[model samples]
Target: MTDTAVAAPTVREVVAALDARYPRSWAEQWDRVGPVLGDFDLPVETVLCVVDCVPETVEEAVAAGAGLIVAHHPLLLKGVSSVAPDTYKGRIVHRLIKADVALYVAHTNADVASPGVSDALAARLDLVMLRPLVPAAAGSPAEGEGRGAGRVGELAAPMRLADLATFAAGRLPATAAGVRAAGDPDRLIRTLAVCGGAGDSFLRDATAVGADAYLCADLRHHPASEHLAAGGPALLDVAHWASERPWLDEVAGWLRAQFGVTALVSDLDTDPWTVHAVSSNKENHL
Candidate 1:
């Protein structure tokens, strides 16, 4: 008997390819990465990529005719006490099975990959060559290998804090709310530090590295105020979903190039919260 090339890579092969590129061990200890369901022997035709796996994204995958969904955030985090159809996460699981869609998450492993989440964010603003914000700990799974999180880079041309904020807003996906800045808007900024998700924890590191400004999401009132008061890097807060969404295309592109399989991006806005619409009274009908 002789072995023949598989018609299409099985789910197991796809998983193996991803693991080789971004080892599961590289994921933060608390993160859940890898296949959540579906058998390894199953054949995968089309894969959809998204920043988060929410109901909307699930629907998008189905509508896009995808058999697999590769998301940056894990849908099943923490031990699931129960997966009954009544629960929210349970419903998501049910939808996947009903739609015959497989779910795989990359989480922190993708975050730490070179040219990953933060790198995509930095590219959006056209930031030049730079270094990592919190260099991956030495001896760690992806460490000493030039893979890390966030980034600190120089701008193409020096611009004021306000101008940078405006520039970022224009480049990134638009949301009901635009970008917001902290510190003197007119303050000149040439060097920038950026992380995709919540990044308050890296304030000291950004400061120590002498970044002129830092861009990320989920900056609390106190932390943003205190960082500026302490003369830390100027801050720019954006929608967490928006900040990380740019990487989905990169991920899908890589999967397509490496695996030669169809890859799609889920356009569904998966962020849980929706901005409220406030209407002016002048529009009231007669």
Candidate 2:
């Protein structure tokens, strides 16, 4: 039997479908998410999913003929007076506008969505029987066990902290930052927790949840050091971009399934720190 070609949805329709899953209302008050730039009426024949909507990813989207870019991070989180072509963010805006590609972001709302960012990360790590690391408020719209900032769960079997770190690095997309860990590497760990991006803010929550180890990104020195000194969970820090990139595939698949658009995930390395130089004699310095 021959199959019929599915028509792609309009940009408005695609944005609506995405908002249905990761509602704008669920986002924090300070967050600037949802559709940023584009003509809603334009038919979206292709979508590009990316962790960050930087120049490289923007070029990739244009090259791939994507009419819409679905990004995890907001391109303009703070209010801006203008989008002049001279500035960086302005250049991105001008580029997307010139290319007729719409831009949409799904920041914190996507984080707290069930089967969302952290959930996707957990799945990649093979975490089982997951629950929210920080549960949403009691009457929040997101109902169920795993709706929150991050996810906490168990490994299929206990392994040394070092082994778990290796497992995570293997599963995650490789980046210049690579993975760094705190706490005793040899410590046995089974219960695990994960937050897909910049999760240092959740260190207390991870400890409170009794996670033996927490896998996250962009953990700063003071917070990590104090947390470990206070007997908190082991920390496995990854690249912010790498930590969130896994969701691109899942989100792209959803876009394809829901709207029949040809969705592609951009594998371009957009993480700001692209190089690392280590000292001799194995004395490391970031």
Q: Note the clash tally of each candidate.
A: 0, 0
Give the CA lDDT, 0 to 100, for residue 198 in model 2: 89
Candidate 2 lDDT over 71-130, as tens digits, reads 999999998898999999999999999999999999999999988999899999999999
- The Cα local distance difference test for each model comes to 0.86, 0.92
lDDT string for model 1 (78-112, tens) is 88998899999999999998887888888899888
How many clashing residue pairs, candidate 2? 0
- The top-ranked prediction according to TM-score is 2
Model 1 clash tally? 0
Return the TM-score for each candidate structure.
0.92, 0.95
